[model samples]
Target: MYRTWRFATGCNDACAIDDYRDICPVFFFGGIHSKKGFFMGIVRKPSVTPPSSRSPVDATPSRTRPGSATFGDGPAVKIFRPDTDQAQVEVPRQSAAADSMITVSSMPSAQILPMHPMAGSLARYSLRAPANLPAANALGLRVFKSRNYVDIAPGEIVLVRETGTAGEYRAALVSELVALGPVLFYHPLSKTWTLERPHPLPEPGKVIDIDIDQLVRKVRKEHAQKHRVHTGNDDSFEYSAAQEGALVARGLKQFPPEQAAIIRSELQAVESIFADAGHAIGQNYKDADAVYESFFGVDHHAVAQRFADSVARGQALSSEYQGTWGDEKFVGVDADSNSAAWMYKRDFHGRFFINRKYMQRGVLSISLGHEMLHTNRIDRFQTIGPNAADYFYLDSRLGRLLNWDTLADYDVPERSVSDAIMRGGLTVEYLNAFTNDHDNFLFGVSDYLGIGDDLPLQTAVDLFNANPSLRAHLAVNNADSLVYAAKSMQTLHQSKTEYAWLDSLIDD
Candidate 1:
């Protein structure tokens, strides 16, 4: 016979059932009897495989049977089983999907996560798989090189937290994949990253190129305009021209037209004098140029032309006075009134200046001739000082009314002039007597002589004595005090006489 048994829950519905084979206690889906007794079915207890040993196994029936015999009328054998073992198989665990669903509900979204608002914005696109999420969180919001995320795809968003102790935050979108790395979206207007993070970044954009030459030209144009505006006024030009004209007018007033003409003519004569001296040793066109530029503010070409004209006229005048009282190669007219006539020596030659107001052509030539004589004597005697005073005195006494007549004659025998002056009245007794008592006389007479102002008398004395050349002239008598006193007295008397004579002539 074959039999089956049913198991029921408390609700009275068949829940689970089993059948067994006869002459064995093993359970199966079907049952069979054995010959040992009136075989109805085999009874077996339900059991689960051990948890540690459970694995995939086939459910095919096995031939092995339990050793239980005498199965007749045993009131339907019921199997005994451990509920602990049974319970292990009865309970079903949740699936992985179910676990994930639960986790998503329980955990907060990154938006609601306890973080700074800026940090939230920075992490907006940074969500990732569970495995990567921890690392992204650790990075926080910060600036980073886009290339750092080599695995990141283009157009994907990332969280880049600066790796520094200062803790900055930023979020970025990968816009491009370059050799270096993914380029992030950075906004220049805000000077920050579009990535939802707060952090400082490198300056953006290339520096604009500029053309320096174009800029220079623009600046020059502006400068020229400014210059034009500054110099625009007619009043300024007129004022400057008038000032120069006034100075020239005042200079012209000092000389009558005829005298001015004569001066021009005389300047012309210097060219021939320079020519006669030769190009090697005389003044050149360059010297003429310098003089014209310095005095007249004229160009070199104009100066040369004016100088040539002046020279033509000057040569004629020079010839006329060559053997007369007026003859000299060079003369300078001092156009300024404050300065006096002077003579100076340079390495190559001597120069003479005649006060323009005090000298006409005649006076200029005569004065120049006198200065040239002094130069010649200086060159000859090689001696300088008051020893020559005797010669002057003798010449003055002898020449009296014939002074001009005898100048050239005296030059013939230079010694004759010397002898004449000594014989005329310079005695050794007079020299010695004066030397002994002349300090007060010298000082007093020097003041009256106007060698310099009385207030600077001592300075004048010091200056005269300081120069060995000048000192020798006044001290030649071996009686310095006497020589000084005599000179001072003679100078004072001569100045007075000249002044009186000039006054009378001017009055006449």
Candidate 2:
């Protein structure tokens, strides 16, 4: 007998191939092991009416219980604790209910499987038993005798049909395990297939009965769907792209008019950064935010709120260097930079802390876009693949929540992967352009230096893409370049005619 309790606890144990008994229990059917040799047996035939508190072996309609459904060939299984003989079963009766049921079969004690000694020795190691066994058994929610398992977690969205609703399917959220069986709660959502919720769902309440088989089927179908790139259906791609564009637009609209306009003007520049990054991985983007959502979901409001909250909390911290990083401004590295240990402190509790000063500089959307793109994405890592050297390198950074390291011990493939991610090479280029823009006080002198805003950034990206040991000195610290510009301007100031021409250029 497979111990299904591990599924409920989310145990992470590995079994050696030789120990078949120690293999983790597969979460096939709900509650009881789908395999034979159950402590007590119940064979249930499909029934429409609600089950009542009745004996497992001889379950017949009891007139005392009004509106009780008869279990013709089916018998009720008693739910019992190992220390007790049996417990009172409470099978709620409903006039129109899609009552779920559990099925188990009797087996000799000698045939019952024993738990692994190590696992059994743990404290409070209760035997796998559902709290709502009586209801589950009556409702015909039992594991199928099969070699398959589908593990569903609480708070996950699932497709479920309500009891007595004539097979009307809607999205339901898995609440918890009652009697070691799944309990689903109905939500008001019409389309429940996605995990993304535009707004928060109300707390899990409103218990509902559902077909476990149908739930498993929905999970299996969606699991398959997640792996395949949606093709031959321009509708899905078009819808997703349009939805993402609207989400970004909405995010932009939330800002003040002047600030929003500044952000809007920078959208094309920001989109170019993402487009160039996507080109590295052969991904074509119709909309920058669409590609962004493909990595992060279409939940812009939540991420923005989270960013705001992080900034607020970070400001509350007692640190002198709370939001001051002059180096970051020089090199287009945002607070998401992983260049030095000091920069790590800018992130409080996995979120970047932005100083209000930065926002007032009209780079609020730019910073938001940078942080949002840096958000962890499992799909992105999967696309990088395990065999790829950059996979482990990228994993180390993302797992550490460092986003991207501008001066990370650079490598060819690592640079490729980094360039493809918004936080990587794209960050270097975009930040330089934004920081050195004529309107930005910080680093704006770069635009006046004759050397283009992106020249240093491009050189850094190219160096990292080719040489592993090369540090991003030029990109990370443009102090020398700034010095050159200052001295050159000072020299021009000494020449009357030259200074007049240079002063005219500044006015222009």
Candidate 3:
């Protein structure tokens, strides 16, 4: 039966072969014997249990019914079936049953699992769990998942959109797990994040700190408004108007009504002269004042006031002239004491001495006016150096009364004359020639005077007759050259003349 069972079950075992061994005991009808001639009546198959069934099968009883030594223990007990070729084995049913009971008892009291520190660090950045992961593992990564992304591992940094803000914020994943609710928390002061702590946004209507770029743009816009350059065509006229307004404002504030009225009238008359003459005054005149202070080391206004007083006395004493000198004398003093005055007389000899005090107003004007007639007569004279002989002939007193028209058959273009006067180049000879007047001594002195040599007499006449447009262009170019020369002269004068004169003038 064991051999049959082995064949049916596909089991190979040494016991199965031994069942057919010739030396093995065999039972026949109830007796057993060995092939070696030993005889025994006992025959039995091992009592065994089938794995599939719980029942145990009884061994065949010994063939000898009465008295074979009953092998109760059997030859050698085996735990496995001998008929099978498989190795010996023990069943684990007892141990497995014990384990199952223990597992059931341990279940209901399970502790909460602590998260990894790495996971906590990653919670700073609002990253999501991987897509392939189960829903339970993906809980903390909702912010990243909503964006269709996955969580960054710890020690990684990511740029993320700041919550409730338009711009992005940077965050570092310092840990892999977080226990608290996942949310992006920014610390502005340290520029970091905290998994344990979070900050709240500002309340409604509260002011927040401005971004640097916004502040810069705002400041640039304000600066553009404040400092935009004036591009209107009226700029030149506007500057003149401002100067007049300044004078009027000063007069109104400082003077009584009657005095202010007189001052305003005087200013109006002077401005009329400037406008009719096409003379660039105002700013140029004030700049001259600064140069005067620098050059003479004295207040230019004080000098001008002193000069004005002298001029007033000269005009009052003289009765031959009837026309108003106006405030020309005052304005002249201020302008001439400055840089324009230097430019005007730069080519003239003894300009320093001639310009000092009120010499131009007193002696020079008187002398030049008389010489103009003589130059008109001969058409040869020039206005430079001394002209005492011509003055004697004309008699200085009557000479002042004779307007150029009476002496010569021409009218002086008043605007051109005024420009020349304001520019300081309007010599008596040039003026007489410009008006198409005749003068004998003018022709005789034209070549003798050094002025004609420095600036040729013909050239001077041409420049004098130039139209306003051409004259303005020339004036600009001349002004630049004049400034350059004046600076050079100033430097030379300081190093040589002023220093040397100071030593002699000041007490040791």
Candidate 4:
């Protein structure tokens, strides 16, 4: 079926489609929620497939825009084209032999209005998902990739709302982070896009008139000015790699003088491992391999071989990890979000779970940190070497993460559940810091690296690297503080949930 939509006079936007190939959400029969009132009609979600080689999924609108709707409701939405005063389009129908044939022979030409200052600018950015019906869908666009996401910081857009030569809306952004209004509406008086909450009442002509080309150029100019420093740190970053290494090397020789020493003490705290398998085999897996290979000269093959050997010797138990962190958010949107200690639990939980996703691996993975909090049998803590998290923690920095002024800090590991991740980022950083060959062997020895609960090992590795990468990316635009603040101010689990163990890993 063919359809055409025309903008009313004083408006210049125009779109018409030759083919209405049905898939989903796009060009489908659905109801639309409008400020004026709910209506059903013959409407469509249309876009030109990639001009060149991109696949259909790639061509699909990467992000949901302001007027985008699910396109599935009580009945097919009739053709709609916003006019200067009314936000409606009429479809004509004529009855014939019990079957009605509807056709509109004429479409009024959309008047060519003077272009706005921000027209054709594909300069793009992102907006946080609002608490609206379509908000969940904001995550589905290919850009999120769900886990392997880059900086969600402002200027880093996953996808742009392009003027697909078909849609009435044309929006995109470039590199520079400039004026962005997720809820932008056209200001008839100013003739420029403004960052204001769109009015609730039905005032169609006075609302947003996005120019994809304009935004594209604007963002580029803005991002160019921001990227000068290179390092994600805007305050002038100067770090001595040598100094960081020397700090760890200094403590290399220290050990508790006891049979049940720091390492053994940690091993004694064994909890069941919760290994989660993931669909991703992308940068996350590559990063883990890279981090391990660069520092310790170890790769996936070696790790796999060792796990095999450990299994052959009965030293390691293989099991699949479970759970999905997708539906999971840093903060709950419902009454749960209203909890008295919402911020603390939500913030830390997101980071903890995110880092866990970073650490995910193919084989049996565990939370080495969580297993260290509760040791059921004192006699069982003697094992070390491959397939044991204890070996990794024996002389490594991971031990530093399990600290407490009071003995209550002992329970932090046990609290590393799905809903709450405790000190997860710190744990990952400590593990990553142990990238030295000696440190790697000390911490990365276990096949079934003991993580009793929450995200599997690979997940942690992914999030661990993901954050720093994101931080660095945002440092370009000075939004690093926004990301950091969100990641920080979080508790081990809940707000009342204090760190249950010692504050330092170095035993006195």
Candidate 5:
């Protein structure tokens, strides 16, 4: 009993092989004569570790919980104790076989963050359980059972990658290993997948609380604008179901009914989300806002209020909307603005919102630059309100919002016949101007709405093609340079911009 080491709990026996027990269990070693018969090695004399050789594991008391840095079927994590900053323990991976050689390392557990602290977005998406069990298994995590492939408990995290054949970039879900301590992940810089402690999502600290109040001020500035037309000049523009139908009828004819139905449902959903307030998502926004909200649970109204407030302030103050950046202006990185660390699950949450395959902020801003030129779009053709002070304010508003980052001090392109191609023709001026005219007409809806013969052309693809430099920033394999899927956000302004209206007016 003198050689036997007991825990602080007082069990007085060292651990034995074949002991499948919880933490704080006794562990001791001996040779030749031990009963329960673990470690049948070649009989050498006196190889047992003596009492003076008590390892740290033997000295420490048991502190096991599900969240304990070391657990099962995973790595032995070297954890930083919550109470102190000191590095405390390294629980080695246990083996059931007594003779099995155990390989131990000093790696810590991985940090599992579905909502990243830095990125103001949900980085990892939780897959719908059991329904996606096989998909989860395909990414290499042994999450499914043998008999029916039932999903394991505890939600699984997945990274989205594009996997379809060339030209058609579809999203594919891959398994991501997340843990409380350092775990394995594919590190982008080194070009190797290695064991790394994942970045834990931080709490929504003081920085964000301050930023939210600042943004609220910005939104208030937006609420004072005169250019918005949704509810104004309204007796003539009450919501019209017939007008909405005629607007998309021809475009609808091109798509299969099933596909068209989904678009219509999404559009109606947009109307539901935005129509009541003067902020109704007009044709310019289309199904983009709805799809964006569905994909990331983004509060469109909140973001829009910010953008609108900024636009209003820009229109009223200077000649255009300007970003809240630069000397005394730089708003800092988007991720650090309001971590709502509680909200983002991954590191690249904001990246997806600013740039994605669907209608993303980049494409919309580019299109806005062109659309702002038409008096109908900017002035709202109202009998009640007056025209804007100048086109400079409109261009600058968009530039501050999307451009100045790229097409420096650029002019908003002048409207012309060629402008018909901009945003697949989904300009609000056109929508509001012709709603009464086209209420009964079903023809030319595709060209009129600015969508291609292939329904509404994927805006991201168009922007992606324009900005070839975007291919490298995303951490996914690009399908011939167009982003099918990516993990990081490349600045939209970094790409070369081609203004359709500018070219048209120049040609004329």
Candidate 6:
């Protein structure tokens, strides 16, 4: 089972392998330290286990320049040296055998190239992932709790490339490096990392050479392509200034001027929300403007426009069933009441559905504002919470089935009493309830903007303060109010509450 192989010149004498078995992707000079330690031969999926502290390789360090070995185009493999962290080593491409036994040998004197610290740092920042795959499948790397992460922090920059393509790249702004794998990045115009796209580390020697000009060119190209689509030949797709005025006029023709004005103000406020969030994050507005407009661009379903027109004409119920908003969008109204408004990206949907029955300015503003977030594709991200406990709660058996329907009833007196006595409070349950209803995630944000000033949220908060009996109802029924109140309590009392994580969720 042992075969002696001569490593190409420049390899350290330690790399002389007398036996090789199941060594793949990369090779390890030192064998396993103990039976409990895993072998490098096993190509791992993300989140399987943490990197072992015990030395799996020899304690002696080696150095090599950051370049491909003469044998093949593949990048050099890194070996772990016990004395130093991530000692650099290279292997001849053809010498990498996955089925041969590997026996460690003594080091022989050879030329040791000096490591480029800056170049190595940049290489670590580079990421690569499979291209043109679903978000879930694309990020197959262990991210929850692995140690494969780069040194880059959240809000830092990194160069990324997709697998199966060469020379194409994206300059990403990292939102987070979750656990240890699948890097999450923010869109230039996004308020939060709700639209986070995860990327895996590059396969050896595949680190991207950062080029500022190339990245700028790619962004500009995206802007141009989006602009072309927006102003393209399809006249029906137009959402021009004329269309905006006409859409407003139709609403005014149907409702009283005062009511219509309020609706108009709400729509404007929604735009302001989108604008402010992007600006606060230092978004590239020149490029982002096109991306934002394309959210309502010509490709929008004609039925969506017709539905809006019908609502404006006071023919909501009788309006030709808005057919479908197509595969990319989800459009619906709250069946129970206008009091309950929610919106988020889940499958997909377009065009906000207005409940014509409740035309009050305050009610309409909240509903419209909430749905508008969805329509504009600016909804909240899906995650249980920021803490380990919250993530565990979400990954639990109950979290998977949690929807608005599966949720505990807001007004259940007996359950409230039991929960209070046993659990102290319902903070965690209520905090995590926004999974199905993303609009509730930003309720505190909307409150800050005065979107639902006259709604039950404020009243619910007052009730929560005044009576213990009322707390349970407000906690579940006025769930959004609870978020707002959480923010208020933290701000006024400077308390470290469960909802402090909401600061990461809010747009500003």
Best by TM-score: 6
Tens digits of per-residue lDDT for model 1, 1-508 = 1111111122121111112121011111111100010111122222121112112222223323235622221222111111111000011235877976644322222221233343333332442222222222223222123322211222223433332224433232232111111123344334333422223344568544666667997986698567532211223322322321221211222345765566546443432342232221122322333222221222223323322322222222333333222222223343432222333221012223333444445333322322222221122121121111111111122232221323323221322322222222223222221112122223322433455323233344444433333332322221112212222222333344458678698899
RMSD of each: 66.7, 33.4, 63.6, 31.4, 35.8, 30.2
Error of 1 at 3 (Å): 99
Report how far off residue 121 is in candidate 3 (Å).
72
Candidate 3 residue 198 C-alpha distance from true site, Å: 45
lDDT of 3 by residue, 238-355 (tens): 2322321221221122334553344335334322322221111111333444333322223234333222221222222121111232111111111122111110111111111111
Q: Give the residue spans of candidate 3 off by over 4 A.
A: 1-252, 267-508
lDDT of 3 at 169: 33
Over 1-508, each residue of candidate 2 has an lDDT whose tens digit, in order, gives 1011111222222111111111111121122111100110112222222222212221112112113312222222222111112121223343443334544333211111243332221111112232323211222222223111111222111223333345232222122111211223222343212222234444569545666667997986697469532222223222322221221211222335664455344433333333233232122223333322212223322232222222211111211111222111111112221111001111112122222122333223223222222222111111100000000111112222323444333222222232333233333432221112111111122322434333344453443334321212111111111111112222222343346687698999
lDDT of candidate 5 over 363-464, digit per residue (tens):
232222211211111221111101111101111111222211233221212111111212122233322211111111111232234443332223433332
TM-score of 6: 0.21
Model 3: how far residue 22 lies from native, Å = 99
List the candidates ranked by TM-score, beginning with the highest: 6, 2, 1, 4, 5, 3
Q: What Cα-based lDDT does every candidate model obtain?
A: 0.27, 0.24, 0.25, 0.22, 0.22, 0.25
lDDT of 4 by residue, 338-451 (tens): 011001110111111111111112110122222211111121122121211111221111234433222112222222210011122234433332221121121121213443
**Candidate that would win on lDDT:** 1
TM-score of every prediction relative to native: 0.17, 0.18, 0.15, 0.16, 0.16, 0.21
lDDT of 1 at 128: 28
Q: Is candidate 1 or candidate 6 better by lDDT?
A: 1
Q: Which stretches of candidate 2 lie over 4 Å from their true place?
A: 1-255, 260-272, 283-508
Q: Rank the candidates by lDDT, best first.
A: 1, 6, 3, 2, 5, 4
Worst 10 residues of 3 by lDDT: 30-39
Q: What is the lDDT of residue 467 in candidate 6?
A: 43
TM-score quality measure for candidate 2? 0.18
Runs off by more than 4 Å, candidate 5: 1-120, 127-154, 159-161, 164-508
